[model samples]
Target: MKNIIIAIAFFFLSYTNAQDKKIYALEFYSWVGANDNISYEMASIIFDSNLDSNDYYCNNKEYNALIRVKYSEKGVEKIFDYNAYVNILYLDNQTEIQNKNGAFYTMIIDGYAPAKLIKGNGSYNPDNFVVSGIVTKNTPRILNAYHLDDAEFLQQNIKNASVKPEYINTTDEGRAKIKKFFSSTDEMYRLLMLYIANFD
Candidate 1:
């Protein structure tokens, strides 16, 4: 009886360890309009057990989330060393999980302004660009923001999908033109879900 009890405990411990060793998949998808000129890329970052030990930095206090990710693009695979701000949404219901299946977490990364370029000679040049994206266990949809405020503006007005190109321009006059064109965040979200659904 003693030997049987020890074996059962060992089996239970092994099963628990196996369950704890889960690895989540991170996927990415990007869309650029014909008229939109933006260059950006996304990578999954895995951090040490402690969240604060990574290299990536997040300005927002609430967004300091990191995980281990195996990022693959164009037939190339690489691991990220830094940490970044990510919002994770956990699906509780099995129906919800199956509805948008396979994704265990949803992460959103916002872009900021005042882009800079480093030359091989160690010289820095001015390159003003912003890249932002929404990531999930299966897909990440990235987009370029015209200016520093573009991402914030889009998030604030996500319900109003009539965003015009002029509004994204980095100018006071352009900001005023935002009302002229509206775009739907729900629509964009649906499109993203569709992309993931079709992905193999």
Candidate 2:
């Protein structure tokens, strides 16, 4: 029994090491709409040459926080890896929130699979966790999308919570009022986009 246990542990460790080296997200320099914008979208798993099915970190689609990344020529070299890209998402998303205080705006929400599940040999559970309100900003401004830390709350109130946004720009105070009324979710940004796309 002891030898068997030791062998299993060794195998698990070796497998994890191998998985850590793999590039899991598919990045693209493609164009969307007519903005001449270059973007990168990541998936939990890159479908084997076929692009047929995704091997998600979590089976639940909502938990996956992968978003298309946009880069200008000036910022292209800066986005060389996941760390830089993710940091940009955080900073840009916050900036959008701060800047849009006095304008008519829309907000989108979305989620991301927890970091643990993104591991090389990690297991997934559907009900594990989620973040909503991934995207939010004034329409013309079109702030970046992102996953926040409290999406699980929205899952409970999803029926009423997933409503289309109204662009109201009274003032910074007004934007704060709007944000305060809605419970921010990790998936806010993506959900907002879905709400707009479906309703519009």
Candidate 3:
């Protein structure tokens, strides 16, 4: 009995050792711009190819980019491997994924993922963890999006809170009141963009 148990354990260990998992590096880039003007986007990911079906990582789709990196940064010398998952969104150009700049549709990567099977629950989930918002062309020096830190946000909110709250409206009367200040029509665009008070 003891010998049989030892043999089984050894076999399990051997099988586990045989399964070699490869961690591939992926460079997810996109065109970071609004309408006409556009720029490049960069964000790296050391993916542990553990998923059973990871065909998406390979150069199987248009978004799957086989990037041959030549430059080196910090210590992680750019892994000249197949990188992709850039143009996930098919907004305008469906035929073309990307041209000289970037991709057609940028995947909205946020913190969310699909969970394990919930037995009876069929709908399951469609949320995953992903933070690619600031994955712009440049680093902190020149961030693509305008982001306010907690400290800065608190400071501004506190300062504004001290003063009597002035709520602006977007209706005709509100626009008329705002226009009476002898201001430009461009300011009307800012009517909807408002800053709320700090929640208790």
Candidate 4:
């Protein structure tokens, strides 16, 4: 019958659409001692298509995507009553989800409110501080390990630190020198001390 044919076509269309979606779990954290401790789940974002491009945008300048906020109240995981679009950024060409344990992406929100999701009354706000985090496909969740305020300072120090040519490239020798320098540097040590001392 004609009705049966239309139903089959609709079913395939819906299935195809669903298959094109991707989910990312976002975690928030603050620095504790020498390590970045896991704070909580900030949100679960769904992308309608493959994130293959190095850059993507919602409008002309805004990188928009759908998000579901997940949080905890009194040791219980609570899904917040908000689902909306948020502006995300991949700062530069070097930024990619495949990078290990780096602040490859950022979510721009207004100010620092530990319990608030996004900006307004559970809506998206573009006037907030930029919070950076790592992304991975191994799980639909993202862990925000570094508070941008503290992390930015440390990152700046890393950029300005003096290093030999052997420590500046992607070669094995370069990687070894980088590891050794960080292990012996007072700047990194001082940053870690301050991070633990000033954690909220």
Candidate 5:
């Protein structure tokens, strides 16, 4: 009987710890056409569902919030959020500039769909291709802003469909155009920050 009582107590303790392991985005919403300038109320609209705990690879790659934990060991607070870790590393070491710059450029430069691969007959892979030269590249712009404000849900969207590496042209002129796009992205990031501040 004593052994049974101890087993029951251990089970309850284990269950409580599991519950406190922290699952985020149970209330995420999927906002469209808006940046992360969303209000807490607005954020709630996209924070409607729990993270898909079963998809560990997806969780690790893009939407890490569900798996990241904030814990304390030996009285020191430790955070597992990938973004937070990067930010701290950036601040603590100026020598890490190259790494930081690479992160920034990659984030901004690869936001758009690549030029579609048109077949000799001019047809393309409908599921994989964006219309060539139609020139509407708003998704990444909105996504970047969303990252700054409602990072949690934005991270979730990235996990769902946006984090995969994309391709652009490798020619010199194409490279120049890609550079231009990244510059525009930086400007958009600044402008969106200003816009949000003014509205707030």
Candidate 6:
């Protein structure tokens, strides 16, 4: 009886620790026609589902996007949902960051179809989705945002039933334009790109 009781206590403690883990998500958000003076909201909410870029991909590319963080604090949860750019998430903890080899993580905000770089203190798993482009209605609201590749700048809208991105037809020039479209000179930005592309 004592052994069984002790085992139950240990399991309870383990589960509680997992539920109250201290973690945060770093979300990269951006809009083509926005500036640095944009304002956002701080919200606390949860959802039933979470997905990645593979579930909804158009093409492969990167972009310089604004950041929003969703995390758990003192047993409470909070999130930031903003305009479209390319969602690349990094989910990690301070201890893991110090121990792991620059390991990052990935996750979507659940509600938005856009990809997110979810930074949480969970594990050393890396992001595999390559977000292209996402355009919004000049507002930072998530619902108004459109996942471009429905990609950032990959697929184009046409009334005609043409599958695949327009760039598929013209190889050189189209690819060049895509490169320029998602170009970033920032050192950290480039590093994040590397992490998102291939870091297992």
Off by over 4 Å in 1: 1-30, 33-35, 44-83, 95-104, 111-116, 119-151, 154-200
Per-residue CA lDDT of model 3 for 98-193, tens digit only, reads 332332323322211333221222322221112222212322111122111223336654221111112233344444433333134222123211
Full-model lDDT, candidate 4 = 0.35
- Alpha carbon RMSD to native, model 1: 19.1
Model 6, 44-122: lDDT tens per residue?
A: 1121123334522222322223333343534544333333234334333435434243323332322333434333333
Ranked candidates, highest TM-score first = 4, 1, 3, 2, 6, 5
| Model 4 TM-score on a 0 to 1 scale | 0.28
Give residue 140's lDDT in candidate 5 (0 to 100): 17
Candidate 6: residue 146 Cα off by (Å): 11
Local accuracy of candidate 1 as per-residue lDDT tens digits, 1-200: 99999988986775564334322323322223222343223322211233353422222223432222222334454332223444444333546546454333333433222222211122111111233434355343443332222434567632211111111223333222221111232112222233334334
Per-model TM-score on C-alpha atoms = 0.28, 0.19, 0.20, 0.28, 0.17, 0.17
Candidate 5 regions exceeding 4 Å error are 24-200
Of the candidates shown, which would achieve the greatest TM-score relative to the real structure?
4
Candidates ranked by lDDT = 4, 1, 6, 2, 3, 5
Measured by lDDT, the strongest candidate is 4
lDDT per model vs. reference: 0.32, 0.30, 0.29, 0.35, 0.25, 0.31
**Clashing pairs for predicted structure model 3, backbone only:** 89-105, 110-130, 111-128, 111-129, 111-130, 112-127, 112-128, 112-129, 113-127, 113-128
Candidate 2, residues 1-200, lDDT tens digits: the string is 99999988986775564344323322211222222233322222121222333532112222122332222343432111111122112223335546444332222223233323221232321211111232234223333333222335676532211112224343443334323322243223223323323322
Which residue window of length 10 is worst by lDDT in model 4? 158-167
User: What lDDT is reached at residue 26 by model 4?
Assistant: 24
Give lDDT tens digits, candidate 5, residues 6-90: 9889867755644443323211112222332221111110111244546321212222221121223345433221111110011
Give the TM-score (vs. native) of candidate 5. 0.17
lDDT of 2 at 101: 49
